[model samples]
Target: MKYRLFGILAVLFFLAWQTLDGMVEGDWGRLEGGLANLSIFFKESMWPPNWSVLEARSYPVCEQDIEFFCSVGYLGMMETLKIAFVSTILGFIGAICLSSLAARNLMPLYISLPVRIFLSGVRSLPSLIWAILFVIVIGFGPLSGVLAMTFYTVGYLGKLQYEVFEGMPSEPLEAGRAMGLSKPSIVANIVIPENGNHLLSQLMFMFEYNVRHGTVIGIVGAGGIGYYISTYLKFLQYDKVFALLLLIFVVVVIIDLLSLMVRSFVNEEGDVRKPTWLNTLLKAKRSKASLVESE
Candidate 1:
């Protein structure tokens, strides 16, 4: 155990040394000076957020101006949300189909093995690289972002869904077969219902992740809030950049809360209970009463 601990520490120290060496090689001499300037820049640019800027509209000066003159910040935010939503939904559909085929218990090795390999290949690439590839193929737009998110979602959700399906109780599936249910019927009636809550939870979590990723993909000209973020930072408009960052933060928080609520509703203890704090308290009280009565 002591040797194992020492080996782990040695590896960690080596990694840290390598990282520091890389940073120094990349020129750390200016970093200290740059940090002081950065502090001043942040104070001047981000201290007073322009809340009214999101509501301000640009006057139409040209065809392109007319296309995006109304509430630039809000419109960008909406586009980001749309990209995340559409990609997640499309990817989830694709994942469900692929997961059914990929489950080892449901399909033979010949069928499932190839699918597992394909999904692994897909999962190997990061979403940013996928976005860049799509942008190269399709040109700069939300289409690239959507395609990137969709493909990444399929890779991620497929693996998780197949694992869930494989771990599911096989007794119900056998019972369905004995009752003369078809394969599709058995999966639809038995497998899905048993894992519905878990699947939904995973989907919601993926959507939340995609929303955060959507903002990043737009930096590569994929057309969302990230595009504006990149633009503002390039022009040194740190106030606008900070505002966009705050907006993204708020959106993420809201989605996280909604996902939590959905999980609570679907995976409620015992029966299908209301996902409310009061309901939780009520359930606790009832359980305590039942225990007393039994005693």
Candidate 2:
């Protein structure tokens, strides 16, 4: 069994390596100076990131007492965050409505199939394409970003939600059915509560995804930090772009921490014991250790 597994993995690895070599046209020598070139480029053009993006623009005439509030970083990041939040909410609601209709356990095959197809159609187009389409229709702004992300969120989340519904234990659903509960009532009182953890998880994940993609859409004049990043790129201002990139990294990390905190409320751990600030701040391993000790 072990030898068979090793052979399968070896074959997969060989295939992947051969495919990569073919794509590169076997020009393996081209990688010799890659590290040195990257090092030189970074030191010469990207080191010592410019901090001016954190201060109010000269032409903006900063009215706020705190100049940071008027800074490009703050304004742009806030706009991106707003777009992400709005889209995540709208998408979650839309996805729930559709997913309830599409789940095989909840609906007949004929009913579920069409809804599933519709979701697939929505999900087929990447968010970037949706952003471009909306940009053309609305002439570019945060609104365009929101609509694009919202559409994508519906498609992605709908699939996840219906699968969660179908995978749930059959007992509660059967009990609900025996009680002559309406489909809406069963969904509202049973399916959602049972899958609250997963739903919240997907919601948080989509919000983070949208926030990151906001930068991409902004490049096409959709509005956000990406617009400014695009401007800096046009002028070859790598230092400013690097600084903005760092800001985005920090924001994404913060969002991840927030996701952990939010999901803690609905997850199994929450049922075992109420979440505490200490648990939220602790590493997962340490939290598990503490939980074990406490128990």
Candidate 3:
């Protein structure tokens, strides 16, 4: 059976790879042309550095006063990331709550339907639009970007979490209730424990999405790498642009690897089984013996 499964997987993988190769080959000319255009664009854009504006912006970056232009640009990126992180966390928590109530098995159609519609609406609005609108109220910076990302994440994560909740086996929940547990107790003791790993996985996955978006929101003045990118690119500083892009690439890749490790750790659900009564009592006795020994 294992061999059969592996064979099937190999065949499927080959077919998928072949399909992708065909698509890439079909677009080869277009891809090459696009690449050429991009190269030309960068070559043309990268001259005449805006040294004057850069000089005016000459202020201390992070209190060290390294260089004005670079510092401001970096400051903007830091703000962007701060917004993304804060918003992602807030949105994820909100989504967890909404997802719990929104699960079809847990709630009736009337309740779940409305929540789903609201979430859908939230998802419909692009984060960029939210940033633009909030930028008016907040008047720029990472604050607006964070708010936009949070709202969007709440919608997205809420929907996905509900799906996760719905897919969960009811047996454990039923077992908890059969012992006369309350709904909240069942959720706290069983639902959360069972879904803890899944939730962690989802959170790790969303971090990448948030980072990508954190870039976009910067265009409307949300801050982060985007602002610096815009500044250098506008001045035709392709080298600096490449430098910034390299930084983003490295950071994102490193974060992605860390997330993968976390996913692996969580998926294992290390020692998830509840402690047996005897095991707990035995451990307690051991602790008591150690205390007596100390005396």
Candidate 4:
């Protein structure tokens, strides 16, 4: 069995390599000196990132005691976070409604089919295209960004949620039916509670996805840090762009940590022992004792 698995993987890798080679026209030499070129580019254009992006603009009268509070990095990042938060929440609500209808186990085929088709249509357009469309429809701003992200999130998250619902165990649904619970009641009590962990996981993932894409959409004048990034790129201000990218990286890291902490609460809830604050403290103490003993 292991040998068969290895053989399958080897064939898949070979096929992938062949496909890539075909696309590149077998010009592997193009990779030669790539590292050296990147090094030179970084040194000449992006090294020693400009910290001025962290300083408040002169035209903006300094109302705050700290300049960083009014800095481009802070404002842009906060705007992006706000846009992501609002859109994720709106999209999650919309997705839950649609997904409940679309899930095969939750709804009849006639209802699920049309809703699935609609979700597919929505998901067909990339978020970037949605942003552009919204910008054209409503003039540029955060509003356009919000609308674009919300639409994309609904389609993407709806598919994930409905699939999760369909994959749920049949026993609770049957029990709900036996209990004469209506569809809404079943969904609220049985479906949602059973799938709480998965729903929360998808919610966090979609928020993170929207936050990253917020930068991309902002390049189209939808308002975010990407607006400043586009401006810097236009002026060949690679150092400032690099600094902004670093700031984005830091913000994304913080969001990831936040997601991890939030998910930790729900992760051990079912058959495993649920962790409380006191239990967590005790566990930490136990770990410290174990480490000391090993030492």
Which stretches of model 2 miss by more than 4 angstroms?
288-295
Q: What local distance difference test score does each model get? A: 0.84, 0.92, 0.74, 0.90
Q: What are the per-model numbers of colliding residue pairs?
A: 0, 0, 4, 0
Task: List ranges where model 3 is wrong by over 4 Å.
Answer: 1-33, 42-57, 65-74, 269-295
Cα misplacement distance, residue 285 of candidate 2 (Å):
5.5
lDDT of 3 by residue, 88-148 (tens): 8999988987887788877779988999888989989988888888999888777788888
Q: For this target, which candidate reaches the highest TM-score against the unseen true structure?
A: 2
RMSD values for the candidates in order, in angstroms, are 5.3, 1.7, 9.7, 3.3
Our tally of clashes for model 3 stands at 4
Clashing pairs in 4: none
Candidate 4 structure, TM-score to reference? 0.91
Residues 1-295, model 4: lDDT tens digits: 9999999999999999999999999999999999999999999999999989999978778799999988888888889888999999999999999999999998999999999999999999998899999999999999999999999999999999999999999999999999999999999999999999899999999988888999999999888888889899999999999999999988887777666656668876423445444445466675566578789
Q: What's the alpha carbon RMSD for model 1?
A: 5.3
TM-score of each: 0.79, 0.95, 0.71, 0.91
Error of 4 at 194 (Å): 1.3
Candidate 2, which ten residues in sequence have the lowest lDDT sum?
Answer: 277-286
